[model samples]
Target: MKEVTPTDSEEHVRRRVSEKCSVDESPRFSRQQSFGRDIGHAAAETYLVTRLSFNLLGYLGLGYQWITRLLALACYAMLLMPGFLQVAYLYFFSPQVKRSIVYGDQPRNRLDLYLPPTSDGLKPVVIFVTGGAWIIGYKAWGSLLGLQLAERDIIVACLDYRNFPQGTISDMVGDVSHGISFVCKNISAFGGDPNRIYLMGQSAGAHISSCALIEQAIKESRGESISWSVSQIKAYFGLSGGYNLFKLVEHFHNRGLYRSIFLSIMEGKGSLEKFSPGVRLKDPRVKKAASLLHHIVLFHGSADYSIPPEASKTFADALRAVEVKTDIIIYEGKSHTDLFLQDPLRGGKDELFDHIVSMIHAEDSDALTKDAVAPERKRLVPEFLLKLAGKVSPF
Candidate 1:
């Protein structure tokens, strides 16, 4: 009924076209038209499709991320199950264990001592140190080890030292020294024998313990006061440790996770030589103390990709070359973590565990008979007999 002018007709057509479009389609059409005007229709269509695909991918990526995280958590949970069970048994089941005994002023300088159920007398001691690449270690990591040794009637001293980013390698090693001193001075009350102490460490812990021993040896040679005697260490057990820092740096230079940590631990260039056990073992000071090295035992997993078995082999060879009594134990088809998980209670057994029990048994036997001396100590018998003969009147 209204008059149809050209301008009125044009306005009516525009309003009708807008009403026909859906809400989302209207904005997309406007954008496409603007883009088409600037960069042809074909190119604008391609851009719109690409944008749509990107938005869809973003939504899908979020779900994929969560799925990956769940898978990783599942894997970790399975790996930690064995250690968790051991720790649970130690805390809830074992009642004789003394825990959180402070050794130094720092909070991290505490240790746990696991005493055998039968407190008949002083027991052979094993001081264990757990590894965390010198960066991440907790005293709880040694709970399984302490329980294992305690079951064999050996006193177990599990130590916790300051970790990196909180303390430097020097501080970490110092904590170990302080802990050893404390153990030597006070372990008798806990049923631990000061004379029959064995030093055992795994991975980064091995490096720290070895360094502490080497340092102690150096101190004794220089007539410095050492809280504990090098001879008191009946044997040194190093498991999956990298003795040569120089080589370790070279080996892991490009590794994304370890490279930065190694660089931080070493401090700067040329500092690796200072902390390297293999390098220091060859030093004149350490060589002088080699005679007091006693028995050294090294364990390595052949299938370990994190740290090759060659590291242990090279270190054992070095010790042998220096005339130190050394033994190497190899675990075939075992990964780095497999060494700890191979618990008899976990439905598996490790050869190194048996070797440790033997060491403790042998040490205990020596203590029961004062006349018995280790085969390595046979050379000192002549002097011991001479002193005995002088003390006796008429035999």
Candidate 2:
């Protein structure tokens, strides 16, 4: 120590810091490289095939029939096939699943309940809502998620609600509310803990779920229909959801068919404030239900062009602004349909699946009870202005 020189000490400190940095970063770098390689390879193959098909179709004078047939096949493959396979698996493999439980009077108001293989006592429940642009969703679409969660000892309920042309957004919301009401009262019979219910919805399902939560909060505030408090639903998992209607109004402005469909879902009214959960929660009228906002965990794909990731970001910001505890997880390079397609059981498991499982098991004591410290306030402005507007209209 008496012979130590400043130059030697500085070199020693630098060497130690370099060693620490190498230890911390090597694994992360390796993982990132592997992920990038996989995504790049897939993207390249898809691009090449698509380009080749386009060139061949152009050369062959592709007709409308071919396009129509191709579109139909794609819809079947993307929207129907996965759900069918999932339902088939559950039916053939999982013996504990109960199918077609009527939750309401309407024909579409039916749900499928999946119970774990072994249950010793009351289990936490996950009520999953499927997304199909508020136009063509089925409860069976949630079969994959329902079965997956049930395998983890969580009770799962996949609900169906009337889509556009058959029912308006308000009606669909009512149907989900009814489904939830039924689950609340009857799930105990299936060995579920009514107190630990979790609401999970994707895309349009997420929008409807948000509406239901706010509606419940309103009812609880007024002391009307207080049978099930909003807080009773331990958490909300909003995957690729549109929480703000104003952003969507701009987003779908150019897309004609979807614009009309979205308008119909809003009952042909431009009530952005009324239908938007983000805007609605900020209103002074909704202060009573502010406590429930902390229960939200928004998940979105970074490459989700169907519904821009910004939707979740802005929604989370709004909730956090009001002091509600909220969390957002971004899945890098994943698209809208890619999220569910990466099934955990099928060896296509991704970080999103792990996140979902973790949240489902998260204890109530671990939940945040107070508003997080607000970051420095910026000039008040519209949320969409902060980022270019964005998804699937359904959750």
TM-score of each: 0.71, 0.71
lDDT digits (tens) for residues 58-159 of candidate 1: 433445433453455355545445446556555433555665556778747777778777777878899998987675576667877777667667888889
lDDT (tens digit, per residue) of candidate 2 on 1-395: 01211223334423432332244457879557545644664476457446545554543354554355456546435444444554565553454766556666774777777888776878889888898767557786787677666766789988889776567888888889888877777677678898889898999999898888888887777778654667668888999999988788657544323455467668765666777889988888788777655478999889887679999999999888777789999888766665764333233334776677667665633221211221222222232321211121121
What is residue 23's positional error in candidate 2, in angstroms? Answer: 63
lDDT of each: 0.68, 0.68
Ten residues in sequence with the least summed lDDT for candidate 1: 372-381
